[model samples]
Target chain A: MLTLHNYFRSSTSTRLRAALNLKGLDYDYKAYALLKKETQTPDFLARSPAGLVPVLELDDGTALSQSLAIIEYLEEEYPDPPLLPADARGRARVRALAYMIACEVHPLNNLRVLQYLATQFDQDDQGKAAWFNHWVHQTFRPLEALLADSPETGRYCHGDTPGLADCCLYAQIWNNRRFKVDSSPYPTIERIFAALDELEPFRKAAPPEQPDAT
Target chain B: MLTLHNYFRSSTSTRLRAALNLKGLDYDYKAYALLKKETQTPDFLARSPAGLVPVLELDDGTALSQSLAIIEYLEEEYPDPPLLPADARGRARVRALAYMIACEVHPLNNLRVLQYLATQFDQDDQGKAAWFNHWVHQTFRPLEALLADSPETGRYCHGDTPGLADCCLYAQIWNNRRFKVDSSPYPTIERIFAALDELEPFRKAAPPEQPDAT
Candidate 1:
């Protein structure tokens, strides 16, 4: 059986869960409390050298980290219900959309980065929240524009199928909403996320659905 | 002809260039001076709302952003000399290694992030350099450990092949060495980088090869 090392409310973990659900794969979850510093333990670091979340321990004993890498591995290992589009360009587009969130937005706002802000710069809650929302706005504006103007955006980010882009965008939107950051600025993002949240895979993969949630 | 929107020293662009070179695909490199705030100009932002470097404009008018996504697209479009390993697990390992550098290391130390540190927090040159090296160490320790212990230590990042991981790792290590960052701590990384630098594709993909370099 596959085992997922995850933390509730981690955008990376949330992304992996969505991919797993979309692929209809079953796995045991080992929840880590990020606030409690469970991820910094030697055992967890051994599983993922980067000490990041969403490590998928395969039955064969290989532990894969990085949400995008894990997602790609799943797509390659299980070709059914394709998460990426068929054509190469389409796949690139899907991956790019995903990266806009994964690489650009979420990296600057993760727990470790935020902790660094508080520890190194003595940023208070207000400072941290502003830092968080600054990135969200820069990213969300483009995302909103893309979703609104591009015909490629269907029920999901690309076509009507729930693909990688939707999975990524949904997770980012969820994080934004959780921080009480206003989403009224991006109606396109809100609309797409609303559609995705209505789906069982996405809704079930949310932070509140996790075993570790309060 | 494929047009690559890039800046000379941007690590992401270097990765794409290496991929292009390794695949033996000829393309036009349209230089964007990132340091001069050229990327934020309206013209570029129209093509890339994120206003980032290493946007690949395909012959069919389709634009691709994100270095990994662009490289993956190239891999799919031109599979002559594969940038990934053959087996699924091997592919996952290559991708994970790539993410180790791309996501964990480069994201924290990139130009914009550094700029934000200075402008937003009044960081001096010393402070900025400290922040840069801090992340390099944070990322390098695990990377060094992975390279030292894993059977994947390889001449490149995986075996003798120069695949996706090698491309990203090589570029980041080059930045490390250029900044006179103490890479002696990561002998495994340094050794692999030395081997990679001897290769023609890597040499050709260096920042000096681009037209924008002073």
Candidate 2:
């Protein structure tokens, strides 16, 4: 059996959950409360040395961390309803798009980062909001430019089907809304995100729909 | 012919260069002076919408952005000297290790982020160094634990052979030294890094050896 250790509201967790749903795979959900520091517990740390969420544990107890890595593992092992393109260049483009968000945007503005900003810099709520919005805009502008101009963009970030990039885009858009980031500047992203929201897998895997949602 | 548009000192660029050397592929180097904002030019931006360095341009005019994505593309195109392990679980483990540094550590402490801290938050030199060192340590500790404890770890991060994880780890360690991060705590990382430094591909890819290095 596949079991996932994740938190409902964490963007990384949501990405993994959406991927699982899209792959039609069933997993046991072992949720953590990030706000309560549940991921830092000794047992959780043993399972995930990074003390981050969305770890996938196999039937034999081997665990995988990093949402993108887990999703790629699923792609390699499952190979149906493909999340990546078959062509090499196309696959590169999709992975680049996903990393543009995953590596560039989300890491800088996630919960732990925001907490560090608050504690170390004495950033007030308004300051935190500004920081979040600033990075969202910085990353979104390039993303908008990429999606708006590229012919590869269809109903989703890459094609008509929702894939890895779509999963990341949808999760990021959801997080953007939480911080009240202005989506008016990114019509392409807004459109793709809208399309992703209609998909059953995305809807079912949303943060609010999770069993651990508050 | 392969052409790489990259800045010498950029960690991402160094990672790509090392990967290319590891695969025994030759490329034309189009050096960029990042301090002069060469990456922001219209032509460069046209190729890499993110306006980031280390874009690998193929002979067909296709430009691949994101260092990891480019490396994956190379791995797919050139199977010999495989950067990823053969098994799905092992590949996932390697990718997770790479992402732990790429996504968690490097993103938080890169040039643009440091500039943001300095300008927006009015962080002094000491403050920026503190921020850089803090994140390096924050990431390195768990990494050390994972590498030191994992049975999979050999002479390098995964096996005796250098692969994707080692490329990232070597690049990050080089950057860590720039900020004067104390490496004494991570003997495993230090030992692996020392091993990597002795390899020809890694040595050839060091920042100071590049044409653009100051």
lDDT of 2 by residue, A107-156 (tens): 99899889989999989889889989988888889999999999999989
Which runs of model 1 end up more than 4 angstroms from their true locations? none
Off by over 4 Å in 2: none
Q: Candidate 2 at residue B62, lDDT?
A: 90
Fraction of native contacts under 8 Å reproduced by each candidate: 0.75, 0.88
Clash count list over all predictions: 0, 0
Prediction 1 TM-score vs. true: 0.97
- Model 1 chain B — which ten-residue stretch has the worst lDDT? B171-180
> What is candidate 1's CAPRI-style docking category based on DockQ?
medium
lDDT of 1 by residue, A1-214 (tens): 9999998899989988999999999999899998888988999888788787889999988899889899999999998999999998788888888988988888888888888888888788888898899888877888788778888888888999998988898788778877788999888778889999999999989989999988
Q: What Cα-based lDDT does every candidate model obtain?
A: 0.87, 0.92
